[model samples]
Target chain A: MRLADNYEKNGDLIVTTLYDYARRIANQVTVVKDQGRDWDQLIDDLVTSKYFGYPLMFLLLGVVFWITIVGANCPSQLLSDLFFWFEGQLTFVFQLVQAPEWLYGLLVLGVYRGLSWVVSVMLPPMAIFFPLFTLLEDLGYLPRVAFNLDHLFKRSGAHGKMSLTMSMGFGCNAAGVIAARIIESPRERLIAILTNNFVPCNGRFPGLIAMSSMFMAVGISMASSSLVSALVVASIVITGIMITLAISWLLSRTLLKGESSSFTLELPPYRKPQVITVLIRSFFDRTIFVLWRAVKVAAPAGALIWFLANITVGEYSFIAYLADFLDPLGRIMGLDGVILLAFILGLPANEIVIPIMVMTYLSEGAMIELDSLSAFRQLLLDQGWTWLTALNFMLFSLLHFPCGTTLLTIKKETGSKKWTILAAVLPTIVGIIVCTVIAWIVG
Target chain B: MLMIISLDQLPVGESGIVTVIDAHGLTRRRLLDLGLVPGTVVKTIRKSPAGDPIAYLIRGSIVALRVNDSKQISIKPFSEVAINE
Candidate 1:
């Protein structure tokens, strides 16, 4: 009988017998090295231990987020100041050249500000995060991460490799979707691609951080406030992980029904991470690439937002009308129309969501940044945002649709528009349901 | 007499020689690629918390196999002193 037919006929017995036969000969011929208790074994004992594995994973995740949040602040401020200065110079030149009001608004207020915001806000985190992540990958910790999570994934009827891709989603969901290619099973890969959006990416960090600071850290000291913010974000991340597992299990049972494919993951030896090489690779490959994509989508969206906010239909601008139209629905979900409109308009890039919200609130001709977290909190309050609204908003943001680029990435990865549409629709439906439930309870 | 036991039934820290991998298609190919071919020795390393998937050391690498998949492969048990060279 042929191998394929034999597999169909005898099921698993043939494969096991073959391996058993191979073992018999190998024992007879080969003199295997008995490196009884190597360093790799020692480390694996702790990392893959049933007890400590998961706690260590969560601890490491918290550390990474803390470092990214604290480390990005100074550089983010410096970049923001520099970019705003450059924006001022550009506006002055445009005025000196007597550029038309519309052209000045479109080019300076819209495109320039959009690009600058994305770069200043996004670049530092990616610069910090990607290298740190790559260092883990280089040190062989990531696979052990896979090793540790393997059983949970297996229990969910999903591939063990989903753990790695989910971690990749932290930097960028588009990259995470692309990283799903590492999984050989097409079914599990689809599951990974569809669920990658649950984990908020670097682009969503500003909004998450803003909300965390304004609401979560109400009375904490400045030193511990950032720490509190980090913890809030970490818990949200944990929530995202729980959701991912739940969704993965759901998908496995319903849409992508098949036994999870088994594969051997060779845990590579831990080595000294080549710092210079990793830095250059991460800087060029991850930081620049993700920043460029965000900037590309953000600039056009920025121009559109500026036009909508500036062009008045009688007294209220188009954006105002949009917010008004969305207000009733948004209220049902414990958010204002302006907040909903910002999320809708910020579909191109998540990094712009808070800025769009700030612009909508200020009703300024351009997106504006508050000088401090207190001002941001006051602004949200003036918009009638309660604690419930903040909680639901964060949950909604965490569960909503992926940005345009990520949807495109899903389409390309899945090669089926049906799956891509499902990817876009699934989380959005969940987000609405979750927000509504929360809102109803709070009310 | 040839004493055969399923790989999943093999106790932790005990080594066995693979005898029969009764699986097919991609799964069968995967097992072979992971050096689970006949004549190779595998030792059950550890189990996760929930304990369905067990880790095994095969060809010097730790490969995790769920009980469902691992149970299909049969192995011949060997004493540790037999292979101590």
Candidate 2:
């Protein structure tokens, strides 16, 4: 063991010597052929060039998000229609069998409605976004994103690879926390894990996209509304990234103080991404995995929400009392009590926040499917929602604590109660501060 | 005598032969494992827009090294070395 330790002490020298010998033998034995066109280097030069690099990165990212928003709408509508139609059939059967009122309400109206809302609203975006993102990863573009953004990250005293993990956060914060494994430094990894929630994941994206589109539709033309909303969402993403850097900087200076570790990132040669493999892998791996988790959480949450909405005390249901209790705090944050309740209940999965809000607003035991965005907007308006409310809700969604799955992942990854708790607390504090400040100014 | 400079000081599109690596412990080992030994040819490819970590062609692969790491690697310009030869 001592001899092995001694060898390990001089491991670098030994590896250098071995490489020297291998190079010498290979140089003598082999003839090298020069490729006429070095396409890889050419593309790298263009993409990483000073003038074009940042623009190209933002443009590509914007295009992906734009496609996701536009492409997801039709499928989301179709799935919603099909699921509600199925819900109608189930209700018919329940009536035909003369099932107990409470049983039918809980099973079909509550649990089934929540599950269907989650699936229809959440699936199409994930299905579209993950494959597009995976295609970029397969094409070796993600590392270049890290490469371009490394300087900013380094300035914030975090590893450059934090950029890659943040990209994963766009899909899911739990996945993002796991991807922090790429950062070898414990300090930076913790920073990445704690701040990953700043980026709104796929679960939150459906809500953000919906709200932002509505926010833009007021004054914008139909032709430009989608584009404007895409830009709005993009800016929110940028804001989240800014918050990530700010918090990373704050952590390094205070709680997790350390010098940024040295890292050598290889800019792998871009490859022709295999389309078939990209689709299948992204579908089964990311879309299905995340959907399953959301579905699992949504059912229990649905039942709980139904119970809250159905079981009344005096004149109001439990949900109304809870919302009334939270009203002052929510009002301070430029949101209503129901919105706050939705966020609290959304702890399990962000995908169900909107549905919960809808269920509570109607004060019904079950969730109702909104026929259109205009009708949705009208409902919110009737409930005293304003432009500021929508804006704060979007901002809150972007800045708030990660969902329950992410907290579990952080605990498992850090294995420390303090850091896991900080991971949850840090972002929530930031969200509260931001929302309160916005409401104070606007109110 | 050829003037030796740190790798980060080498201009983009310039080629240099490494002369010494002034790093230790895991950092030193990592640099060596990446083929940054004495006499290896390294070329600066480009700079990221924010311009701290620079990409270089090392051992036929493009690798990005932060200024902190690259500044520790000393190199002699290949143009000057060829003239000396």
Task: Compare the candidates by lDDT and give the number of the best one.
Answer: 2
Off by over 4 Å in 2: A1-13, A25-37, A364-369
Against the hidden reference, what TM-scores do the models get?
A: 0.86, 0.93
TM-score of candidate 1 against the unseen true structure: 0.86
Cα deviation of A27 in candidate 1 (Å)? 13
Compared to the true structure, candidate 2 yields what TM-score? 0.93
- In candidate 1, what are the lDDT values of residues A1-443, reduced to their tens digit? 68767555464456557656776898999997766447777887888777888788777876776787788878877887888788789989998999999999788777777677677767776788788878988888987777766777877778877888887898889999999999988889999999999998878865676677668877768788778777887788888888898899999999999878875566666778899999999999878877877777777777887888889999889898999999998999989899889888888888778767766676643335544445567778878988788888888899998998899999988888999889888998998899999899979
Whole-model lDDT values for every prediction: 0.80, 0.85
In each prediction, how many residue pairs overlap at the backbone (N, C-alpha, C within less than 3 A)? 26, 0
Pull out the clashing pairs in model 2. Answer: none
- How do the residues B1-85 of candidate 2 rate in per-residue lDDT, one tens digit apiece? 7799999999999999998887776777789888888888999988888787999999778899999999999999988899999
TM-score of chain A of each: 0.85, 0.91
Each prediction's fraction of true contacts recovered: 0.45, 0.87
lDDT by residue for model 2 over A1-443, one digit each (tens)?
67856665577467778888988998999886656227877887778888999888777777887888788888988888898788889989999999999999788767887788778877887889899989999999988888888988998899888888998888889999999998888889988999999988988888888887776557867667778777778778888999999999998999889878888889888889999999999999888987898788888888888888889899888898999999999999999899999999999888889878876786543334565556677788878899889889999998887888899999999999998888888888998899999999988
